[model samples]
Target: MRCRGLSTLAAVLLLAGGVPARAAGPLLVNGNGDPLVWGVNPIPFNPDRGTLGTLDNAAAVQAVLDDFGVWAAVPTANISFTNAGALPVDVTVANYLSYLGVCGDGLSPIIFDTDGSITDDAFGPGASNDILGFASPECGSFVPPQIAEGVAVLNGKWIDGVDSPSNPEIPLADFKGVFVHEFGHYVNLDHSQINLVEGFDDDPSNDDAVATMFPFLATGTSTPHLDDQVAVSTLYPAASFASGFGTITGTIFRADGVTPFQGAYVIARQVGDPRLTAVGYASGARYFPSNTGGPPAPALRGLYEIPGLPAGSYTVEIEPVSHFFTDGSSVGPLDPPAALPGLPEFYNGANEAGTNPPDDPTQSVSLVVTAGATLGGINVVINGFPPAADDCSAATVISTVPFTAGFDASAATSVASDPLQSCTFGGPNQNGHSAWFTFTAPADMTLRADTTGSGYDTVLTADTGSCGALTEIACNDDSSGLQSSLTFALGAGQTVVLEVASYNAGASDVLLFHLAPVLP
Candidate 1:
């Protein structure tokens, strides 16, 4: 993740675990191809879970209701929730599991884990770090999977002022937002990625730019984003939604054009007002039957559809999901999102989109969409630009010392590097658009390898031995402003592999690397 400033940073953390993908769709749909929603309108919930940490029971109940109201207030969505009072018996951590019976009970229960005991009992130790709250479908059908009943839990330790040495308090105001975020999942809405710079930049002041259903929780995003509103509206659209909004359908392809690129993010930005954009779609957003032991649906990978778009002229673009948004913090349909070897490009009016070498961002065509009309065949073919040394096995060989080399990482692809490598503070340890080089030491000496003239922020790592069996020797980030330099000793005949990578995703620059022996 990118960090612009330390003082401005907001509390941000990982969210729920991965869910199986079905045709790349964002909604949690049933076998019948419908989003699993409350069959009955005005979903009822038991919010009386007693006092939650420092917050009173009434405050906790009101907070949950306020979160539900955030979704219910969407003008385009026809969904609501009502308080069904308390459960028959007080649900302590010991008895909460028994209340979570299979099938619909009509009463959704909310639990307050004051001491995080419930989280430890439910998910195991240290779960509170990533889990502020979670919602699960307790009662549902498989044939046409519908959520007849559900339960939600909030980690009260997050708001309780008493800070534990293990789990510190996550600002009370920010903790309140988790309820809103978890509720989005309760209503079957999946994660959406939009204005992703906020998530990647580590600037929580602009958290409102992200969707509430975003895979991670960021401070200030308590309210839902336009994408979140659209998601809920699409699932339970009001009468005017279908007639007042438009849809765009397209396919994302590799440079080959034949191969589809699943998990690519597609955004439809309104021509003049970019804020009025329609996003939150991964290519191929449909549910497949194979996941439920039924025959698979027709191939829909790389396909994408963005609905709830108001009639307007918009420009569409495609890029890979942020690498940071993975695993427990995954976005779209694919967990641990795919690192597509495609340049970020805008959709130009090309007869053969992806086949072209360069999809220039400056050259784009504005497409006018009509309300209720489904615009099809907006296929975008991404130009492949994987760097020659994208992998460690293909490391560029450096024959001599006191060497300087040039690199263009604009369209480079990032590969997995050793996790144990030490990176300095002030930047993410992970490398983006990484390129590798191998050097065989001719003599015993101490040498300094640095990206002294890199146009963008760079991180450098050096390791000994082969790619599979290697020991990290040195790693540095921001040794110099927006550049990296590290010194290490190499024995005669020993080899070292060096990795130079961008500090942030999609960050590119013409780089100049210098390697020279250090003299005492």
Candidate 2:
């Protein structure tokens, strides 16, 4: 798991698979739950003599200094750092751990491991394989915890690409990006999910929009996004910071309208230019076993506030955290993240209960934000409606050939299927968000069905007969990559049931199910 700086002063951030004991918010907090910040400005840091593989000592040191400049350059944030030159002695694998957690002694060191030895020593064996780097706060106080000092470590193997040639050797620019991000944590900033799209790291197109503190490093740039700027400004605001940006506050609720919903991503996107945005999780997001237990009262659990938004008309929406971004790569508060019970929707003042239509993005309403103002009561109650094709009884009908449609199984529930006895399409005990679709043959023909363009591993199955009593005709798995494909024969006027399911639980995104006639 990530080492997010939290409220407790002495709290330590353990690496992957370890329990995430600390809590997080827009800003890191102290023991008394006050926001944490450096009581002094121009924080001084000492660097070691080790090189980042190809980058010599001078180049590596300059990279760290330059990245610190990027954060100091934020016009609204009163944050600055100075390079205090080399450490008293080079901290290598021999005695690096001793230098860690040494706070209030006026030493904040940045150690560089030319190889994976130091990294493995600190985190464990094979840690350097995946972890880029990490930062931690060595607290000096607990009440209204103020950061006296901190420490950070960078693994050079990512840049050297020696251990694993297949591992993407980080570009110098992206390396600086990682420096800025780790420094963000060093200065007591937790991970923030803004302008988030699942699986965004592999696709560089979304690079410019990602936040510096986003859990995973996308196209790493030295520059911090608006979300990062606001977070820093919230802790170390300049005189003009407040007057320069506006705030939006609200509460998110379940269909019952009484129970608050936490862990939902709340985003405010500029109406005309969607590139400009800000995001936050609901108030109780950091609490484990979400929505019920937290330091905050039940009434305040789902409250969210987005600050540092420029004056403009903007639309707001809520979506579930991506299922892939859990555990070590977790986003927001809940580790092993939770998905929203309903579909992603906007704040249009309509909530789904029994009869109300499901909330839609197209129906979103815009609100005007002004400088130095806090707009409150912009509440939203998400629709409780499940996907239309969730059950066989509500199966969506397809009449023509070569048909393809998008389906989201994130909110779809598993149906009754004896996979071991009836079929092995998805293996025994496979999680079935099995969405249903129907097709009738115009004439007897062989048809091929496949989930070729799906985002996650899928299982495709064909069945004959009604929902209650059905026999599996054909099922396929891993026909191409992790996608599934199958072919079936049918007579004229015959109808077949198509069930699209996943091998992994809580899979979403467009399930591209393609069906076409096979000409012989």
C-alpha RMSD of each candidate structure in angstroms: 11.5, 9.7
> Candidate 1: deviation at residue 386, Å?
3.8
lDDT of 2: 0.66
State, as a TM-score between 0 and 1, how close model 1 is to the true structure.
Answer: 0.71
Q: lDDT by residue for model 2 over 1-520, one digit each (tens)?
A: 1111110111134222112323234334432235556778898788987787678999989888988888899999888998877877767889886677664557788888777578778667876665677775654443334667777788777788453433435666666767887888777677766665421323366667767776665664457878788777777889778897788888877777778787677888888877646555544443333212124344445777787889998888777655434544466556545456555677885443322465554478888989999889877786664453877877888777655444556677775552322334444444466778899987787788887757777777888898877778988767889888889999999999988776655466556566766443
Show model 1 residue runs off by greater than 4 Å.
1-27, 31-33, 101-106, 293-296, 389-473, 476-520
How far is 311's C-alpha from truth in model 1 (Å)? 2.8
Best by TM-score: 2
> Alpha carbon lDDT of residue 396, candidate 1?
79
lDDT of 2 at 265: 75
Give the number of the best model, judged by lDDT: 1
Q: Residue pairs in steric clash, candidate 2?
A: 1-15, 1-16, 7-29
RMSD score of candidate 2 (Å) = 9.7
| lDDT of all predictions | 0.68, 0.66
Q: 1-520 in candidate 1: lDDT tens per residue?
A: 1121110111111111223442223345443344455666888788745677798988888888888998999988999998888766656678777665434455677777776777767667876654677664445544464566767777786677876556656777777677887777666676666876555445456666766666656666677777888888877889888888898888888878778777788888888867536565887565344344334344466778888888899888876665445543566656556655555677887654543434564467889989989889888887655343677888878776555545557677765654434674554466577778888877776778998756788788898877767778899888879888999998988888988877755477666666665532
